[model samples]
Target chain A: MKTFFTTGKGICIVGIGIGITAALLQKLGNPPNMGVCVACFVRDITGALGFHRAGVVQYIRPEIIGFVLGAFASALISKEYRPRTGSAPIVRFLLGFFAMIGALVFLGCPWRALLRLAGGDGNALLGLAGLVLGIGIGLYFIKSGFNLGRSQKTYFSVGLVMPVIAVGLLLLLITRPELKTGALFLSTKGPGALHAPLLISLAAGLLIGFFAQKTRFCTMGAVRDAMLIRDFHLMKGVIGLLAGAFLTNLIVQQFNPGFTGQPAAHSVHFWNFAGMLLAGLAFALAGGCPGRQLFMSGEGDGDAAVFVCGMVAGAAFAHNFAIAASPKGIGPLTPLFVGIGLVTCVVIGFTMRKKI
Target chain B: MMPDRIDARGLSCPQPVVMTRNKMDTSKSCSFEVLVDSGAARDNICRMATGMGWDVQVTEDADECILVLSKK
Candidate 1:
């Protein structure tokens, strides 16, 4: 039952599409080396909602909204929108929660890691190592029978929740409410303040979301499949991403290499590695990368919706508690937060397995 | 001889793979037949079983995917 999009070549096109879109977005005005960062954008959106007072990083990114809505549209069009829930929702939430903390520590998610590498950031090498190692640990658990149980089929409305939220957010973005009390929050400065043209960003998001849904493009899944089963089906997409981004960056002349002054990135090498490691483990446990989770939410997965909510809340906790990293360095409470996340993930991995 | 049967249909993701892993870890038999409805699940089981030094053969009809795995 494989369609044209499911083939290796097809998924490669999807990956290349995402790479080119992300690079193009950066060239268009998004942050350098950060065209479409899910975790970072989610944090910005969280800040924009006034969930946190991180002034430098608060804006309602249209790309995220478009991503969710686009995936929703694709799912509906393809008749693949199946509502599912009840697969340890709280644990899933916590996984997403810690995953965010981990990602923020590194200042990006898996896709951003690849993008950073394409932008010639040497720091991304360490982050990639951390991601691989973390996912490797999670693979150990998987080999030893780690599982979070199965999700049951739920109502159709359950699946529509995230998309509905996306629509509301789009409206809020359009209206541009002036409220000191609540509702919408926009950043006046910093990375959050920088963005590409709204319509173009949305268009890119929709295109990426549409093809990603069809091809099942997942960064974590690509790494996991490569490590665990040695199947390169999804890995091909990952390579396409790197190649596409690298070429685009070369064309745009944004390929600056060095660790001294990379944009929107810090050189705290240990934390960078540890952060992505924690994120990798969390993604492995949670069953998908952050963007994949968003796409799943679009496709009516209530479980993924819960995970997404957990991530949004995690962004708040990271900033409000001052645990997330900045360009200068790691936060004051980063070690404490990341330590707790690592131990918690290990406990979940061990305790949740179906032994015997 | 007959193989151990693992019906992983209706399950998603790591569950199917995890189920197969646990079964492979605990069972005495060297062969197994796993039933899965989703392509992801079927591929997961096939890969895990094959990686554990077993040969895997996959058969799919309209309803489900059948993975026949054996150690030789």
Candidate 2:
């Protein structure tokens, strides 16, 4: 029969996996510990489309599209497509928006933070610690009857929104709109500007999405489950992903161990921690990470779709307003925005909690 | 008479197992292959295969893995 393990195994596995994914990403020609970064890539995509003029960090990552479409396809084939909605939708959106902001400030999400550590960036340690603290705070709220309300079953069309949006983005990607004639946006330079070939990127995204959905693989959920239920079943998958990537990286000879001048990384320790702290807390409070949220959104969660949209908007805002950080350091407005986000998260946490 | 294939590549864990269960009921002499890229996926697939009374063999590739299962 089916058996469940303790959370420790899962955590250790995730640690090892992060290390592995770091090496693999480097091997695959991705910046160290950046095999897949949701926030950064989105930001890069934003910049590529001329959302902001930030250079030196623009590239369209196939992994992003792969994550959602993969999940979409998997959920469909496996019959896990249960469309649902109505769970403090606006609040979740705001959380996603701020979570993106925080991640941009740190220049990575929790996943990237771990990868950064694996790639020898000490500054990532601060971000990781901040993530833990943020999650810890969220746990306190969760323990104290904090909830964002319950989600209810909704129409099938509601669930299709995420996948549809992803497909739209893909089509636009292929069509390549011309701005002079006034069409959809596209990045020309910087991190947003960089992209792997379209087909390769889409295929990768589809594959990962399928696997993740089938396994119910979720990094944030893995950590949250360990902390809350003391369970590790989900955690093992995270570990496996990391290990797979790491082994691949080693085979490809991309292991670089140390903290300074890592590609697409910065040295600001405090913000790294603080930024992830905000993201972790938001994720914990929202009940999923950015990646997980994308999967959920794809599987017919209108609320999650809202959150995903929030992330998109947040990315736009981060860049448009210069609140996002760069390799040089935290952007001027990032700290203030993060502060506001934390306060807002706490306020929502307290106000929306179910009284059970 | 229909040979069933479970393309579980990119699927995480319990998902492949769950889908396998769903797929097994639809076919006789079920021959299935689960695709994955991680050891955990392989492990879970094998465990489920055994529990379901299916014979399983695992094969690995550079960035992909396959778990072939047949009802015993």
lDDT string for model 1 (A207-308, tens) is 888888888889998888887757787888989999999999999998999997999899999999999999999999888999999988898888888889
Q: How would you encode candidate 2's per-residue C-alpha lDDT over A40-75 as one tens digit per residue?
A: 776666555555555555444666766777777766
Clashes of 1: 0
Task: For model 1 chain A, give the 10-residue run with minimal summed lDDT.
Answer: A1-10
Score candidate 2 by TM-score against the native. Answer: 0.76
Taking all chains together, each candidate's TM-score versus the true structure is 0.91, 0.76
Q: List where candidate 2 sits over 4 angstroms from the true fold.
A: A1-32, A48-60, A181-185, B1-72
> B1-72, model 2: which lDDT tens digit per residue?
434566554333234444565567776665877666434456556655675688988777654567778888
Cα lDDT for residue A18, candidate 2: 39
